[model samples]
Target chain A: MSNKVTYTEIVEALSRKTGFSKSKSEEFIKGVIGLAKQDLDENGKAVITNFGSFTVKEVAERQGQNPQTGEPITIPAHKRVNFSAYKPLRERVNAPFAHLETELLEEESGTDEQESEVTPPPKEAEAKKEPVSPSSRKKDNDNSGLMIAALLLLVIVALASGWFLMTADEETPATDQAAIETPQTPEATETMDDVAMEENSEETNTEQVGQADSPQATEPQSDSLPENPETTEQRATGSVDTPETYQVESGEWYWVIAEKVYGESGFWPLLFQANETLEDDPDQLYPSMGLEVPELEGTVATPTSNDYQRLALASTMVSEAYQRAGKTEKAEEYARFAEKWERQSRQ
Target chain B: MTKADVIKQLAEELDLTQEETDQLYDSFVEGMITLLSNNRGFTLPGLGSFHAEVRTEHKSYNPHYQQMMKIPPKKVVHFKQSSVLRDELNEGEDEQ
Candidate 1:
């Protein structure tokens, strides 16, 4: 027996259990989520003991590179929140509702059986009270025969019309071929020749326009090029460029700065690693926090080959443990993890 | 087993018709998808919870070939099973 549970069942069950309207239940759920986020943000941690814990951590500032240009850039400090499941909570979250589904299915089948039994009684009762005449039965049979004949005639007419339309379409293609083979008038030819000449002149005009516009485009290109060169030189001389320095402007959050630098809000941890001098609190960043931008190491940061091997080993271990415990779903999960890590290592 | 097969079994067990089973299954899946897509988690008593987790895009480095490749950010679906289910499955293993 399988218990297949769905969202509707969840919502309906919750509503019924709580004696609340569906909409009210949904609103209550949303409210709980909002409260959870608020609790995490305000208290640094939100713990629902049977469920999980959400914790906000501060990530320090760091130096990263623009992936597109491979040029080194400073990734500023940031804050991020993460969730971790308690053991019992994790188990509950992954549990299948197969038993519940089986129960629901059995209840429905029982009702259906009852309904089927009930349906025959009414039919039997109706049959006991009603009788048909022979003349009326013969008249009904004749009417049905006439209706069948009409339906056949209609089908035949439809087929004939379809055949005619198909033949008409086939005949038109020959005329179309004949039209294509026919020669155009000299006047028409002359017009086409004039159009081609006009197109050639248009192309020449476009080239002239492009040449005239080159100087305007070059002016901005030259200005932008010099700015970069000066900045590059300043960077090479180990001097901080004022324009590139991320000044802690008013109304700035550390997380926001971290997001700008790392191109993701979650990379604040790397930022924290780069700036060890700053306080560890992500929300406590102050103005004029001097951040050191690290030079590019010129190597792509990735999990090592050993990490993949370890992940594979861990997954296999987890699966074996799960199988030994008779946890089919958990075993399957570990199998999926092994496959995923294996593919990642291969890539 | 296929989702439909599971739903069918649920229907049989719950005394529901095939049509009702299908409706329940669809609503459940659609609801979960909607919640997860919105980066929310849903909980069902005696079942498990479904949630979305963010994954960082890591650059792939090959030491042998000396190549670096950029990975992209992704959101993944995560599920956790309930204690009742886990305990039921693991009960026999403790004796062994």
Candidate 2:
């Protein structure tokens, strides 16, 4: 058999083998080729079992240079037909090379090949990943620890501020009790001095009141006089040893005086309640006019709605007192306090 | 076109029965396989040449296993189309 046989010779051999007419065999071959061409033109593929497949491939347009003229040109895109023979046919065709078998390199040779190729080993990559995971975990732990410490510090600050405010409220009543006990003994002067020092540091007017009361009580002790009428009078009314009075200072209002004496401007109406014989309008007070600072009978540190109610009642009383004095303008000015207090209590 | 279509067309052209046309087609296919398997190559004058080639054994990487794999030597059929056929296939499109 020849290495290459022409199509006509194949048709001649087919006609002889099948005992068919040569013309009919040639027609069959032509039909097969035509069918392949039509299939490739239409669907871009044609398959013949045990023979081969024809496929149409697209070649893209590209830049080209003409060899003779040396001028740049654009090559147009086009379709091309490709062919691949079947596996069984290929196996039979390649029988002469069947003895060749593939070989795999061992581990040592594989590592040597990898080194020559300049690719890192998988074990080394794994080693690098192992350390990175722990370091990232440690960083996460550090971040979480820092967040927890910051949260703890915030909670402690909140608790400490709450405790300080509570103690400050509790200390106000103790200072009031010390004031009431001031004239009982001359020895109380030392305690009063200590309380006054704290009041001065706190920027309150209680220090001046303490100093004024202490001097009066200690003067009698220094004189060593027996049975003074003022001292006997002080003993008779222990609660009101010397009515603690505050002289209205220049540019001072009732609320300002209240804040100075009681440490809270909300107790402003307490000033009006203590001064029963005050004929002048409570809103209008002349400097140097004496206003009494009465003992705080109830809880005034955290004033409740009841305190606002007391203020409303005190406003009504002042309005009535102004009306009795025939000061209609003063009465009208004070009348708004009842309405304001009522609104405050409702809230 | 399918084998049935080719058989019918061949039967009409040859003035033969469908069974004879079908038998004739089978004989042609068997003759081609026998001739091609024995010879190195054959040329279809108007179309192309069919040749068998032997691929050498080679190493290939299996990415899924992260290891090297072996591919044994194998045979493949190669088709080199004739200039006449190639020119004919591209003739209509070249004008565009």
Candidate 3:
């Protein structure tokens, strides 16, 4: 219950313990406390072995009220003493808990140390890093890989479809009539370009062989010119207020369809929302299915004449891939669709 | 422990005169006071290091005086136990 632990009393105890005169014992105690004070004054802290650590922190100025006068005042910043017991001493203070499992005691001590560190809030800020989403990291590989594979496969299929369509055209003379009535779709436009190129080659070969043959084979070609204006009229009419129907060709995914129609791949949702076949899986577009290519409201943009040709070429190749894969139903349907459009654009 | 008891024990243990020990104790205390007043800290090996520190100026209210006060920046003295001493203190508790 005795509270006072004065410097004089400490000196007396020191003197008695060392069997020294009162003055000598007092002087020893004085020297130690004195050095400690000087250290505190200059360095703001002092350390004593087997005891604890002392630190001095600067307390910032703040507002405070006088208890008696009820008057507000500014409390200026000042030095504050802090004590942290060494690991050994601290463990001793917590000796009662030390009997518990050593790991548990250590864990509790570590948390205490961490909590003490948290007194300065800035340390917490350094602990947190900018969170890059795990999902974003995971998707990087899949996206790039899928894009490259799809493009390579599409190119190979397109070339094959072009060759197939040319051979088919040589056999079917009735295709000339259907070409006049059908509206030029993207697939049709591409088929026509291929057909025209193949015909030029064929014409040269025919000339080489027809040294003895007659020129009557050129008559059907002359008949095909007047039918051109009729198809142009239909393009103009097709560009009017109504939405035109498109026959889905092989290898036509909603993403590509949206890009061809809307000028952006992101518009795939529009195609997915508009079509029934795409309802179950927007990526599962089969060849030869009729799709209502709805006109965008308030905007009257249509795929360019060139776009139709490009799409036709691309889809024709996609169908060829289906043929090679043994899905002949898909290949034939898309071939029929492309042939229909090619004739339509022959005008 | 009391000063008399300490002196008695040291006298017995060292076979030295109490008067001689008291002289040695006095000189050590004087040396410490001189160094500390000048804002220096003393270190004892196997004990710990001692040093002084400074704080910036600040203001505060003195409740006892019932008035606001501007407290100038000042140094404070502190002590830390040496690791050796701390280990000694922690002894039996650390035994597995």
Q: Say which candidate scores most in DockQ.
A: 2
Better of 1 and 2 by TM-score: 2
* Model 1 TM-score, all chains together: 0.24
Instruction: State the C-alpha lDDT per candidate.
Output: 0.42, 0.57, 0.42
- What's the TM-score of each model vs. the native? 0.24, 0.40, 0.24
Q: Which lDDT value does model 2 have at A232?
A: 31
Summarize candidate 1's per-residue lDDT along A1-347 as a digit string, tens digits. 01233555556644533455666445434433444544554576654433456665655677888999999987655445455765543322222110111001122223353334344344443343233223333554578766644543443344344434543444432212112322221222222222223345333433233122223323333333223323332343344211123334345654465455433333333333333221223344443332333322221245555545455655665565456557778678767877776777677
Best by lDDT: 2
Clashing pairs in 2: none
Give the poorly placed runs of model 3, Cα more than 4 Å off: A94-347, B1-96
Q: What is the DockQ of each candidate?
A: 0.02, 0.16, 0.01
Better of 1 and 2 by lDDT: 2
Error of 2 at A41 (Å): 2.0
Question: What docking grade does candidate 1 earn?
Answer: incorrect
Candidate 1: regions farther than 4 A off = A1-9, A13-347, B62-66, B94-96
lDDT, candidate 1, at A346: 75
